[model samples]
Target: MQLAANKGFATEKVLNLHEISHSLEFYANGRLVRNDDGRQRKFQGVSEVIEFVKRNGGERVLVVLPLDRVSEMNVDSIEPTFIADNGALALYAVRVR
Candidate 1:
Protein backbone atom coordinates (compact mmCIF):
# COMPACT_ATOMS: atom_id res chain seq x y z
CA MET A 1 0.00 0.00 0.00
CA GLN A 2 2.83 2.38 0.75
CA LEU A 3 4.30 1.63 -2.66
CA ALA A 4 0.98 2.27 -4.32
CA ALA A 5 0.66 5.53 -2.42
CA ASN A 6 4.15 6.54 -3.41
CA LYS A 7 3.22 5.85 -7.03
CA GLY A 8 0.27 8.29 -6.62
CA PHE A 9 -2.63 5.96 -6.02
CA ALA A 10 -4.65 7.10 -3.04
CA THR A 11 -5.15 4.57 -0.28
CA GLU A 12 -8.81 5.23 -0.02
CA LYS A 13 -10.08 2.36 2.08
CA VAL A 14 -8.86 -0.50 4.23
CA LEU A 15 -11.11 -3.40 4.95
CA ASN A 16 -11.04 -5.61 8.05
CA LEU A 17 -13.06 -8.72 7.32
CA HIS A 18 -14.67 -11.10 9.78
CA GLU A 19 -16.96 -14.04 9.53
CA ILE A 20 -20.14 -11.98 9.42
CA SER A 21 -19.13 -8.39 8.75
CA HIS A 22 -16.36 -6.16 7.52
CA SER A 23 -15.23 -2.67 8.35
CA LEU A 24 -13.76 -0.15 5.91
CA GLU A 25 -11.52 2.69 6.97
CA PHE A 26 -10.44 5.43 4.63
CA TYR A 27 -7.09 7.19 4.54
CA ALA A 28 -5.59 10.18 2.76
CA ASN A 29 -2.20 11.82 2.90
CA GLY A 30 -1.02 9.40 5.56
CA ARG A 31 -3.94 10.24 7.81
CA LEU A 32 -7.36 8.79 8.32
CA VAL A 33 -9.98 10.23 6.01
CA ARG A 34 -13.37 10.67 7.58
CA ASN A 35 -16.50 9.62 5.80
CA ASP A 36 -19.37 12.02 5.50
CA ASP A 37 -21.70 9.09 4.93
CA GLY A 38 -20.44 7.07 7.91
CA ARG A 39 -17.26 5.90 9.50
CA GLN A 40 -17.91 2.25 8.64
CA ARG A 41 -19.18 0.61 5.48
CA LYS A 42 -20.07 -2.92 4.49
CA PHE A 43 -17.14 -5.29 4.07
CA GLN A 44 -16.51 -6.68 0.62
CA GLY A 45 -14.57 -9.75 -0.51
CA VAL A 46 -12.53 -10.56 -3.62
CA SER A 47 -15.52 -11.76 -5.60
CA GLU A 48 -17.44 -8.65 -4.66
CA VAL A 49 -14.48 -6.52 -5.60
CA ILE A 50 -14.35 -8.20 -9.03
CA GLU A 51 -17.98 -7.31 -9.51
CA PHE A 52 -17.23 -3.74 -8.56
CA VAL A 53 -14.44 -3.50 -11.10
CA LYS A 54 -16.63 -4.98 -13.80
CA ARG A 55 -19.46 -2.68 -12.84
CA ASN A 56 -17.18 0.30 -13.14
CA GLY A 57 -16.14 -0.81 -16.62
CA GLY A 58 -12.76 -1.97 -15.47
CA GLU A 59 -10.97 -4.83 -17.23
CA ARG A 60 -8.63 -5.83 -14.41
CA VAL A 61 -8.64 -6.41 -10.68
CA LEU A 62 -5.78 -6.33 -8.20
CA VAL A 63 -6.23 -8.52 -5.17
CA VAL A 64 -4.00 -8.84 -2.11
CA LEU A 65 -4.90 -11.87 -0.05
CA PRO A 66 -3.32 -14.43 2.22
CA LEU A 67 -1.37 -17.11 0.33
CA ASP A 68 -3.26 -19.86 2.07
CA ARG A 69 -6.54 -18.67 0.63
CA VAL A 70 -5.29 -18.64 -2.95
CA SER A 71 -6.73 -22.04 -3.71
CA GLU A 72 -9.88 -21.28 -1.75
CA MET A 73 -10.37 -18.16 -3.80
CA ASN A 74 -9.89 -20.05 -7.06
CA VAL A 75 -7.11 -17.72 -8.14
CA ASP A 76 -5.39 -20.43 -10.15
CA SER A 77 -8.44 -20.79 -12.35
CA ILE A 78 -7.56 -17.50 -14.05
CA GLU A 79 -4.32 -16.30 -15.46
CA PRO A 80 -2.86 -13.54 -13.32
CA THR A 81 -1.82 -10.25 -14.87
CA PHE A 82 0.76 -9.76 -12.16
CA ILE A 83 1.89 -11.59 -9.04
CA ALA A 84 4.35 -10.84 -6.29
CA ASP A 85 5.34 -12.90 -3.31
CA ASN A 86 5.96 -11.47 0.16
CA GLY A 87 6.69 -14.46 2.33
CA ALA A 88 3.32 -15.92 3.40
CA LEU A 89 1.30 -13.32 1.50
CA ALA A 90 0.87 -12.52 -2.18
CA LEU A 91 -0.45 -9.86 -4.47
CA TYR A 92 -2.59 -10.89 -7.39
CA ALA A 93 -3.38 -8.47 -10.19
CA VAL A 94 -5.50 -10.17 -12.82
CA ARG A 95 -7.59 -9.36 -15.84
CA VAL A 96 -11.23 -10.11 -15.21
CA ARG A 97 -13.68 -9.57 -17.99
Candidate 2:
Protein backbone atom coordinates (compact mmCIF):
# COMPACT_ATOMS: atom_id res chain seq x y z
CA MET A 1 0.00 0.00 0.00
CA GLN A 2 2.77 2.41 0.91
CA LEU A 3 4.67 1.68 -2.27
CA ALA A 4 1.66 2.39 -4.44
CA ALA A 5 1.04 5.55 -2.48
CA ASN A 6 4.61 6.62 -3.02
CA LYS A 7 4.24 6.00 -6.72
CA GLY A 8 1.24 8.37 -6.78
CA PHE A 9 -1.26 5.65 -7.61
CA ALA A 10 -4.73 6.05 -6.20
CA THR A 11 -5.92 3.48 -3.75
CA GLU A 12 -8.92 2.70 -5.92
CA LYS A 13 -6.65 2.05 -8.89
CA VAL A 14 -4.76 -0.80 -7.22
CA LEU A 15 -6.48 -4.17 -7.47
CA ASN A 16 -5.90 -6.65 -4.67
CA LEU A 17 -5.59 -10.22 -5.88
CA HIS A 18 -5.92 -11.87 -2.52
CA GLU A 19 -8.98 -13.83 -1.49
CA ILE A 20 -11.46 -11.55 0.14
CA SER A 21 -14.01 -12.78 2.60
CA HIS A 22 -16.98 -11.13 4.31
CA SER A 23 -14.71 -9.46 6.81
CA LEU A 24 -13.05 -7.17 4.34
CA GLU A 25 -13.16 -3.49 5.22
CA PHE A 26 -12.75 -0.44 3.05
CA TYR A 27 -13.80 3.13 2.78
CA ALA A 28 -16.59 4.18 0.42
CA ASN A 29 -17.88 7.73 0.17
CA GLY A 30 -15.62 8.68 3.06
CA ARG A 31 -17.10 6.11 5.41
CA LEU A 32 -15.71 2.82 6.66
CA VAL A 33 -17.69 -0.12 5.38
CA ARG A 34 -17.56 -3.86 5.71
CA ASN A 35 -18.11 -6.36 2.96
CA ASP A 36 -20.64 -8.46 4.84
CA ASP A 37 -22.17 -9.73 1.65
CA GLY A 38 -20.32 -11.79 -0.91
CA ARG A 39 -20.90 -9.21 -3.63
CA GLN A 40 -17.25 -8.80 -4.54
CA ARG A 41 -16.26 -10.25 -7.90
CA LYS A 42 -14.01 -13.29 -7.82
CA PHE A 43 -11.91 -14.20 -10.81
CA GLN A 44 -11.13 -17.72 -11.95
CA GLY A 45 -7.66 -16.68 -13.07
CA VAL A 46 -5.27 -13.77 -13.41
CA SER A 47 -6.35 -13.00 -16.95
CA GLU A 48 -9.92 -12.39 -15.93
CA VAL A 49 -8.85 -10.18 -13.07
CA ILE A 50 -6.66 -8.05 -15.32
CA GLU A 51 -9.46 -7.65 -17.83
CA PHE A 52 -11.85 -6.63 -15.11
CA VAL A 53 -9.37 -4.11 -13.79
CA LYS A 54 -8.88 -2.65 -17.23
CA ARG A 55 -12.63 -2.41 -17.74
CA ASN A 56 -13.02 -0.67 -14.41
CA GLY A 57 -10.32 2.00 -15.07
CA GLY A 58 -7.73 0.40 -12.84
CA GLU A 59 -4.08 0.59 -13.87
CA ARG A 60 -2.21 -1.41 -11.26
CA VAL A 61 -2.34 -4.95 -9.85
CA LEU A 62 -0.92 -6.10 -6.53
CA VAL A 63 -0.24 -9.81 -6.43
CA VAL A 64 0.34 -11.52 -3.09
CA LEU A 65 0.78 -15.19 -3.71
CA PRO A 66 3.38 -17.90 -3.95
CA LEU A 67 5.93 -17.69 -6.74
CA ASP A 68 4.55 -20.85 -8.35
CA ARG A 69 1.04 -19.40 -8.41
CA VAL A 70 2.35 -16.16 -9.86
CA SER A 71 4.16 -18.05 -12.57
CA GLU A 72 0.89 -19.66 -13.61
CA MET A 73 -0.69 -16.28 -14.39
CA ASN A 74 -1.06 -15.07 -17.95
CA VAL A 75 1.08 -11.93 -17.94
CA ASP A 76 0.80 -11.05 -21.59
CA SER A 77 -0.97 -7.77 -20.84
CA ILE A 78 0.89 -6.71 -17.75
CA GLU A 79 4.47 -6.11 -16.72
CA PRO A 80 6.12 -6.12 -13.37
CA THR A 81 6.81 -2.66 -11.93
CA PHE A 82 7.89 -3.68 -8.47
CA ILE A 83 8.74 -6.89 -6.69
CA ALA A 84 9.24 -7.45 -3.02
CA ASP A 85 12.50 -8.72 -1.59
CA ASN A 86 10.88 -11.98 -0.53
CA GLY A 87 9.33 -12.60 -3.99
CA ALA A 88 5.91 -12.98 -2.40
CA LEU A 89 4.48 -9.64 -3.46
CA ALA A 90 4.57 -7.90 -6.81
CA LEU A 91 3.11 -4.82 -8.45
CA TYR A 92 2.23 -4.87 -12.13
CA ALA A 93 1.49 -2.08 -14.54
CA VAL A 94 -1.27 -2.82 -17.03
CA ARG A 95 -0.29 -2.24 -20.62
CA VAL A 96 -2.55 -0.27 -22.89
CA ARG A 97 -2.43 -2.92 -25.56
Q: Residue-pair clashes per candidate, as listed?
A: 0, 0
Query: Estimated TM-score per prediction?
Result: 0.47, 0.51
**CA lDDT of each candidate?**
0.42, 0.46
**Residue 80 in candidate 2, Cα distance off native in Å:** 3.1
Residue 48 accuracy (lDDT) in model 1: 62
Report lDDT (Cα) of residue 46, candidate 1: 57
RMSD of 2: 5.0
Where does candidate 1 stray beyond 4 Å?
Answer: 1-44, 73-78
lDDT, residue 49, candidate 1: 53
Candidate 2: segments with Cα more than 4 A from true spot: 18-41, 72-74, 83-88
Q: After superposition, how far is residue 45 of candidate 1 from its true place, in Å?
A: 3.7
lDDT by residue for model 1 (17-54), tens: 11211221222222222246854332245566555556
